[model samples]
Target: MMAERLRHDGVLVVGAGLAGLSAALAAAPAKVLLLTEAPLNHGCSSAWAQGGVAAALSADDAPELHAEDTVAAGAGLVDPEAARLLAAEGPAAVRRLAALGAPFDQRADGGFAQSLEAAHSKARVARVKGDQAGRAIMEAVTVAALAAPHIQVKTGAKLVGLLQDATGRIRGVLARIDGQPVEIAAKAVILAAGGIGGLYAVTTTPAELKGEGLGLAAMAGAVIADPEFVQFHPTAIDIGRDPAPLATEALRGEGAKLLDGAGRPFMANYHPAAELAPRDVVARAIHAERAVRGGAFLDAREAVGAHFPEEFPAVFAACMGGGIDPRVQPIPVAPACHYHMGGIATDMDGRTSLPGLYAAGECASTGVHGANRLASNSLLEAAVFGERAGRAARDERPASGPYAVVTAPELPDEALQTLRQAMSREAGVVRDAEGLGRLMLLIGDLEARHGRAASLAAARLVAACALNRRESRGGHFRADFPEAAAPDRTFVTLDRIDPAGLRYAAE
Candidate 1:
């Protein structure tokens, strides 16, 4: 079996979303193997991103203002330098994507068209065809990946574990392609796989992002940061979809309003900015409203009106698919787990605490999105950090030999559904000590029975972290401790994580 393995002298990247694509392109002239569980576009949340990348491309805006907004939205835990780096480098990254043929929306003056989203001080989101930015940018990057000479793409390849060397440094990946196991040895392993949104019963992410990337890194003993801060998008269209369709934040950025079942506007009651409040505020408001008013909804008729078909075609199509018309009727909405602000912690260079292992995209917590990510910043983070990780990985030296392969764990279908339900019920928007303790007990049982599936590990990390943080801030809202406390960012490695603590003593 050792002789059967294929080896590459450069980076082996797991996941083919924007981050992986950017990494592959950045590691130019080096041998790169890009692996994906689904065809390039099918499994990635990047393509489903309707909001554009946030950058200070407009003349009136500056990186300082963007950084300020980012820090403000992150609720006191944002690293100033990381936020500054994101705002300063974000414009160049957007320009690079455009150079690669991303179709950004342009104004009559031939400049990039920008829009405003929640928590931002200005209109800095660079969009494409209104709601098609993600799809368009991803399409352009995918084309570049396909044309790049150094990248070798392997679709339908599911990564099970990282291949580590005798010295505990990651050397490569152990993946299953077409139901057959394959080992690919490389100089470095980069996990750009994505977030753990799919761990919840209801999410607005791709169904496949079930905590594999974060779990694999954690299983390999990497530090996990802020795992409790799960950002729930306030407007996932409630259309009975498995992975709910998003009614993009850009709608509200453009002036859409949130309403209750009686068609009464409600956001104004929660925040002074109403529809323009930070995401966590809006999500919690919606959750609270739905608890009493039957349900919540987004009324875009007054804001978008007849322009819905032209300005937000993707959203229009989604509304049409669900037997709702955005032009006249209020679209049904719910709070769904949308983004993970917490992931395998990494630095500006995208290097994790472990040697030879790197992370980027939604899977890497660079301390930029401290506790809650600002609208449209996710794509920017992926681009800037993915390229950095790729460039850094390209310069690494290969391991002397491969590490021993271990069997990856899997939960029975019954256990998987139970885990999802438990996460959403306990670890979702509103959390309490009692619920978190119960969740920890359940997670312990699942770990004992399932042998640490990536999904289980990710769920436990979030639940344990949520239990430990007694105060509510940003995406993490503890019903038991609702008031904001002193600002503090959490950092934890696998050894320090004790779900049994309930208090997150290890944190």
Candidate 2:
């Protein structure tokens, strides 16, 4: 086990997507060791994002407007301060990404081209091509990071657990490289490891990212916030793909409508905004439609017509592979798990409650998203908070002391699969008290069997939280109790999981 004692300088960033790359770049002049479970360009949800980044880049738009839209979309739980920070810094983040060579679509006037997404009052999302914003932005950031002298990238290294010192402060990470565990000690660690979408049998995230980051942080006793709120994208191409390909919201933005099997537009009956409603509303509408009308579809023929392939090559290719033509007919769509709003709780500066551990990207709950995330705000959140965390980590120096690596117990394959299925069925798009209670019982059984596995730890947090929240709100919909109650954010920790009541300190 000679590989067990390697050390690194600066920060150890787990996951090498936009957030990790952005963090590495922002911590420039200081050395950074970036690790990825897959190759540089693969296994990241950032590449799968098609809706582009939300920012107020137009003269007619303002950050205050953007903040208001975000709060409205979040269904009354969005932190006002976090929303304000995201709104204020959005333009600068988009501009910086553009400066790194992101080929964002531009208007004839040379300003950034913007489009409307669901729930936004104005057309403010900056895009590339049509749905290529994620890939384009990632490509640009990867180029900059690869060229940066201070960044050292290690591909195919999967983070297994966090390494904490005697006092429970994080010191480094334990990673598995080529089937061997290696310990790398650093001053600070940033967990940017996406979300729990992959935990489901069907998702929009890469299959490999099965909530390892969230599980690892929870096992290390980190404060996990809003673990029950998982966002399901309302329009994933229902082509029988295991990890379903996405149909961009931009198609709907361009006037495409959601229809049923008989070719009838159906969203108008669900919400006044129809196709332009926030994701939670749209996802529920689609789910209800499918439950009643067999399935839902996106009709893009008149909206983009022959321009579909050139404008949105990814969606076009996916449609072609399924023997469907977006130019002629509607693309079949269904609601699928796409993002998670709950994760390691962090401040605006991306510092977690634990001293030496920080988080960014989808894995950090800065309270900006609350119960539901606004469209295209995820990429903006990653960029803005990634930079903040990087700068803060770079300014600090590690104390001089000997540190020991702490390893959590490993989970078996069967136990992991059981946990995933439980969470997917119970705490999924729609839930109820009976289902959540069954899920909590299953979690306890799995934890007892697996002896405190990280996967069980994460599953318990989600199940417990979902069981506590009695009313439907945002991404968390209850079929039995299907109404919004007094608006408030729900927070939970491991100690709060009880048979009597779910209790955590009131924020």
Candidate 3:
């Protein structure tokens, strides 16, 4: 079919999660057009986030302390300035969400109730009814976006390609609205799409997210950062589900234990902090224990117990529906791909290498999350950087010139499934040069047979970068080289992905 052309005289935002909504709302006085592949409150990883937003909300907590925790958890690759910026603006972001009608659990003294998770020194994660943080916050933001006068949201509009002029400046996007091809021209394009968890067979994110935004940006000559750093959640409830349900980390924060299949606690053997160690440590521990012991489980029977429903209703429902009761039994758990610590390279204000283009949220690597993300910082990054991307994009003038859409071929369902399984086996948690090389071969075979789909581009980036990085650091662990190297970040464009010549490009 011939493509339909439409011109949007404002900023175009992709994905409708926290970041996209925040960007649209922040682009006040400048009209905004937001496009999402899924309906509001679904598909996007934001609403399914069980952990709350991380912020220094209490009197004893400060942004500097929060920044310290973030930098420490990142394993030395975090941009100190970006981490400080996120930490400094976190409290205001949480308050902004609350002002939009999100009913966060508050203390008796009218303060934000906080929980301590993983690496944080303070109980600074602001939540709602224990584990409803993402849903509650997204609901409020969705309502506000719907009511806003300057924002126009179009659901079920899937991004297929990016539109760029002859000078290689991004002008707009090529999307499919209900299977009909439509070309949208805008002043600036802000990519707020989520992560690449769906690329793995076992994951905690919605299956619809396959790093298309990241791939499209790279295809349009934007730089990618740390494509090999994928974070796996340690407590994904393994109930034979495709996209496994997540058991909130707060359960461990509340004193839950990680036990082997024999019901013996095993985390103490992995790290001194045990259940509260950094997420990568815990995930690797679980992966190791599962290999030898048949399984690893989270025992919340004594921690939350009778308060399971009230404390974590989502976990309780998922367990009950899967024939496991958290009140008395341990929930079977495994390391599942949860977040991408890498994406389109962006500055603190969300500007990418290409002019007239910006990126935010999980899709953009603003250096707050270096090799591994600190727990609960995902939502904070979305709100803080998403707004910055919005304001920055609002200042762009419309590009003059005929635009061309660089579209990618689509991968069939069978090929996608094959790729997912391969990714889980080789690149999911622990990786090595041998396995990464095998994965690269498979990616090349699939691309040659199925054409270069966006999914293929995303997977190729991860495999290529993982193969090039020999040393283990944070989320990008290599079993062959299991020690830390000098701190460095990886920056590559499509043209620079020569694996034999690739190095960790330090900025």
TM-scores of the models, in the order given: 0.98, 0.95, 0.98
Q: 296, model 2: CA deviation in Å? A: 1.0
What is candidate 1's lDDT per residue for 1-507, written digit by digit as tens?
Answer: 332477888899998889989999998878899999999888898999999999999999999999999999999999999999999999999999999999999999988999999999999999998999999999999999999989999998998878776677887788888777788889888899999988888899987999888988888888999999999999999999888999999999888989998989999999999999999999999999999989999999989999999899999999999999999999999999999999999999899988989999999999999888999999999999999999999999876754876335877888988988888898999999999899989988988887888887888889888888989999999999999998998888766776464655533
Q: For residues 435-497, what per-residue lDDT tens digits would candidate 3 score against the true structure?
A: 877887888888889988888889888988887787999998999999988888988886676
Question: Between 1 and 2, whose lDDT is larger?
Answer: 1
TM-score of 3: 0.98
lDDT of 2 by residue, 130-244 (tens): 9999999999999999999999999979887787877878888989887898988888898888888767766888877777788788767788888888899999999988789
> How many clashes does the backbone of model 3 have?
0
| After superposition, candidate 3 runs with Cα above 4 Å error | 499-507
lDDT of 2: 0.86
Candidate 1: C-alpha RMSD to true structure equals 1.5
